[model samples]
Target: MSSTPSASLFKPLQEGDPGDVGGYRLAAVLGTGGMGKVYLSYTPGGRPIALKVIRPEFSEDPEFRRRFKQEVQAAQRVQGLYTAPVIDFDTDGAQPWLATAYVPGPSLAHAVAQHGGLPLRSVLLLTVGVAEALTVIHGAGIVHRDLKPANVLLASDGPRVIDFGIARAADTTALTGTGVSVGTPAFMAPEQASAGTVTPATDVFALGQIAAFAAIGSPAYGEGSSHAVLYRIVHEDPDLSRLPTELLPMVTRCLSREPADRPSLTEIIGLCHELSPTALHQGEDWLPQTVADSITERLRLPGPARTPQPMPTVAPTPTEVSPSTPPPGTVDPYAPTGLATPSAPGAPGPVRPRAPEPPAPGHHTATPGYPANHTPPPVTHQPSAPQVRQKSRRTGLIVAASVVGTLVVLGVIGSLLSDGGGKEENKGAGAPATSSGPTGGDGGAGAGQQRKDPKPVSYQGIDLTDGYQLMLADNPPRPVQSEDAAYDGGDLYFKVVNFLDESSIGTDNGKLVLLDNARKGSLETCRTETRYTEKIDLDQLTQGSQICVLSDAGHVAVATYRGRSSESDPGSYVTLDLQIWRNAQETDGN
Candidate 1:
């Protein structure tokens, strides 16, 4: 290891800080975040590690500890070439902490802030590494909800994604409050901004934002107050004007408003591959030279120096005596003792033992005979014979249950097949004696005719600007200005010019119907016959009210009114959660 310390990379420990924790000596404070502080330390074998110690407030909370323990266990199972795997953790301690292999490099955020944006080639390579890391992370059933530039580190090998699932454990706690979002506002996906369901796709949206940030040196949505940025993310499209030409398409697809519209991690890797075939193997030159130099400087930092505690001497007992033993405090002349024998008159007659030195405050004393850097092996408990037998019995019961469940499933399938056979025979015999149900096919089996309705596409928290019309028939619906929304230009129009009294949703050429009792309406509820009108006043409708519409293009849509976009700014327009069924005529037989 290189022994050149860079003062910039470390800060001296403050007063009252522990010198040693769980056998790892704290060299310096690496960094601090909202949740806790990170320290640079070394393992028993002299391997460097980044140890994260939880803050007292978070550790003391019972709920945080419970969630933290679960997250730690799951994190330990995450193993990826582009990730720093958890090597050790202590969740049940007063202050829960975990250790991971130290990455001697600056974070992407710091690198970019110190230097400018990276070159196109370096950004492509960074994408490949992070995408690969996400693949491994999601495979382990964990989402890296916080994938900002700060959570990505630039090393000589490649980019490493850190702080994977830790954000989730801190989410919805008293510290953050219930229903509050848990990610950086600049990089948050639209769904996250609206309190919608978050999934793996949420990370993909953040990934796109990261790429834009790396190539353009600023956030996709211009930086400002959190509220303003979130509003843009939910209502406005990202400003990709400054992004590199080659990266625009991939980034755009990843930033699609609907979660279903974003590309998968696999697709992202393929796009990176197309841009640079050898992106993953760029090695030390993957980062720009200036950033690479920073990594070099960090690698040269020296390890923490630990003072070895002196071992106490004990008189030999009769059971430990042997023929080769020397007299107390006297060295055998023929033996090659490393120490010099006391022969001078003024020399001490017998070497007097000194009391062991007390360890520094907040520091644990080193164990006798072991080096200061040595860490004892962890203790493990083995199951007893009785416990093993009990486990075997439980396994047998589980196996028996599985067999019974399989038989039940098979029987159900056989019965369904039998019923289907009877129906086919009746059709062949031309038997048509059945009571009529609903007027249309309605995705039901009617008189031996089997029909299925197309699945409705759902979009949540879609904002419609005042005076602009929304095109619900579009694959992923979009908004169009009123002038462009002529005859068949759009589906629903937001009329906010007359305030709450006259503000309503109306189709210029089609029709609208209010579904009073169907607040939780779906495609089935929309199929029932109801009076259709050109417009429905907003003043009479409350939040959570449902409106079914037949667009000018002949497509059917169910819109749930989600109230105005901003309560403080009444002119900001309203929000709607929508579900649209395309080609409605085929199902309705109109």
Candidate 2:
């Protein structure tokens, strides 16, 4: 670790940075970027580390979150001589974060700015160390699209590469399309600028750029706007005039315009040995005398360099659960790519189909929840005032018809009496019937046969598809097309822009969840003509939250999530409970 005092290494925590993230107590700002913020924190053992918390905007992006989760999972395989490996990460949180072992050192950018270009010996050692880092990164099937002075750390022990294995290889791809490539223009290889195929060679090109920067204390492509720098990288040759004669040939080969022509990492390491001494190793003084002296001086000083740790109970670990059990039906987090794919923009929605008969309540489906033996009940939304009003109206109509029938029967009996009990024809026509089978004239329509199930003003609906089933990625909001649908039916066809994190709720971070109800199904089948998206705050919900999706045929599709099917790694996608309400009137004004 660099001996730099905490004061020099960290800045005071600002308003936006959280007091704590996951289980780590953030102490100071290590660095900030457009994508995320890196904070200085420590573990339970008092070991200092760097914690990177993704910005909320990016965290809300389903696509970005999915890719980031995969990258973090893959990153665990890397353990390199000169790379700061990620120690842990939370894929199911509102603010996704990852912690890496801290290397107490200044960034190469800072190092070069403070002490001028690294000496020839230091440059060779730095190049070799970073090359070894790349080999490990590539072994994990990752390419570091961004490699520059800021990413290279001049640790007292050796140079450690930071922020590796986060970007992807293809997009519409020349490196720019993947949404993962955030490469700096000056250091970006020509192919990256042109969106060419990114491979391990792409990283080698970046390494060459870093080496040139360290040699001359400036960029190989010189300085200008990002566009100008990128233009130079693609159209003009590198101005390696400031690079020393000894290291020129190797770094030049690394900067080859064609990725196929660039030297491999192993070849670059070999060339480093041929050009400069390789005696440098961990704990050896490899930095320039001034830089080394500055770092060594801090080791002799004493101050409160480490921040204090949080109490044991402040931020609970994932393995632990809250005291009160969540009402049964709490389910796994939302899967962005299940059956809920968003339709193409401006495409008309499909016509509504006659909804199939849904299974009775208490029948568990294969969603992310508890084991089959512990199938949780479906969540029901509270009956609203309008629903009550509709029920009353129907009751009044039935009562009025019953009164008229009773009066007519009495009048017939009176007429029989008036005729001195001799009117046998009228008696047979109004004769009461005996039940041979059931009520309503021998099974014409029994009470049991009559649909007694209450209209579902609000209830949980689940899609029981298996996790491996493929689905759509996104669907824009659309309007309901039912001619008899409510005036504000379009409002019911809401498009869920962002949702609250519903992953095993009770976290301070996620109090609300947004859902897309209208656009559902895979590529071929979609429930298009409906407008209804919902936002539910998990913290606020005493029971399961209600997600009311308006249907095309003047109805509402209400769904509520419950417990998981099995705790074992709940498969690749997420599950939901869905129930469609026909002739829905509760949300008419809305």
Candidate 3:
């Protein structure tokens, strides 16, 4: 296995991101999720670690903090060959963070996406490693509530399970209140989906899903929205017909709906051993050539520098001034500009006179536009008589009317310029103005702009076959051959084989959320909805069925199924109208 460190694995810390936390200097951003960011850092002795900083909302809760401390202690005790152990942590701080031994390899999800499903032997070996890791984890009285493919790192030595006991701590937090599920939708156990008791068996169910995903390149329960997947896990049986014959019996037993019916970790390890007697002896050759090469590339990347980069500082916005407050670029004559010097220890300090009292409400002591050293003359009672007050009121009304008149003229001129400029710009760009339903191509100008509803973009006549995969993230979305280099980054794949007339659309790096009866203007619904899945079966939909696809590039696209090309051959070809909202988060008008 290559031990080279690749720099491409790390992204530079962004502005306002802390350069260092505790004593460890952050090298770069490892990744980010809803929980918080993970940074690549090194110990004082130079050993690399993945430091995960909890988000403020989670860390600020006293209940979460107390649970976090307990979990960190249990996680530190977890020591196994296939698990990344927590080495250091600080739960007492304002933002609690924990450091784990960094595993220099792509996640199982990334590896499978880059290279197709793993060979049968490789899957068997992966099962053995993960099962053993679970044995050690369960022995330490910790249940890995969430054990999806992304949490498993494929190292040269073997698979290393990460985020083991962390999920338990998060489950107790207010973020995951009562009756809410904590794990990923596709891999969640029946009990977890229904918010029932979770045990080590819950991890076993997820492990089975991971194994099936590695061998079949998609989840067994079939995916769409989180609700759909969770409903199927709780009510419907998993479609394991596509699973390899050698691994069928084991995976079936592991995915049993009832927790008690699921096989124990020891039984799972034994089952894997039966499938591949020499699984332990596969060594570095266990992974396929493509996956092995990916791991080698990741290991060869150079580690980040130890020195911390300076954090960028943003100038504070100027405060709005009221009648009593001093305006910007001007100083108050009555306010002190310098501070008194500190006196020597135990020495008598000079007696300083008290400052003047503040002006009463609705009164101004300092004159406008005055210099720092300029002091205004003392007020006289002669100017405050009733006749003088009337004159001042009339002057104020005149100034206010003049200001309003100037603003009205400026508004008219600005509106005219904006309309003319917008028309000319759109004409030069050759973009459409009126909404003519969904049409594809960056969703035009108004697609992701703030405060305006995104225009729907359509993609018609899309064909889905066995060897060709759909690339939703690409401009002018199209399909490419399974063996094509584009397939590595492709979002969805359709598989059709004999005996298993199953046809499904599955993604590796993106999510597909089903919207049952949505129309053309479903972009806003897609952007706001949170439930997402990796794949969805064609049999579950009908004509005019809408599906929202959150692309790998963070673009929200709505895929409206426009029926199949041929009724006899449903999987041969299908039509879809897409409305892609780019920069999905910006559509919220933040």
Top lDDT model: 1
lDDT of 3 by residue, 67-144 (tens): 676566556556788998765566666678887888988898888787878888899989989999999887655678
Report the C-alpha displacement of residue 529, candidate 1, in angstroms.
59
- Model 2 clash number: 34
Q: Give candidate 1 misplaced runs (Cα > 4 Å).
A: 1-3, 178-182, 277-280, 308-590
TM-score computed on alpha carbons, candidate 1: 0.54
lDDT per model vs. reference: 0.71, 0.57, 0.67
The worst-scoring run of ten residues by lDDT in candidate 2 lies at 470-479
Q: In angstroms, give how far residue 312 of model 3 lies from its true place.
A: 28
Error of 1 at 116 (Å): 1.0
Model 2 alpha-carbon miss at residue 330, Å: 38
TM-score of 2: 0.51
Mark the regions of model 3 whose C-alpha exceeds 4 Å error after superposition.
1-8, 177-182, 277-279, 301-590
Q: State model 2's lDDT.
A: 0.57
Instruction: Give the clash total for candidate 1.
Output: 0
- Cα displacement (Å) at residue 39, model 1: 0.5
Q: After superposition, how far is residue 111 of candidate 3 from its true place, in Å?
A: 1.2
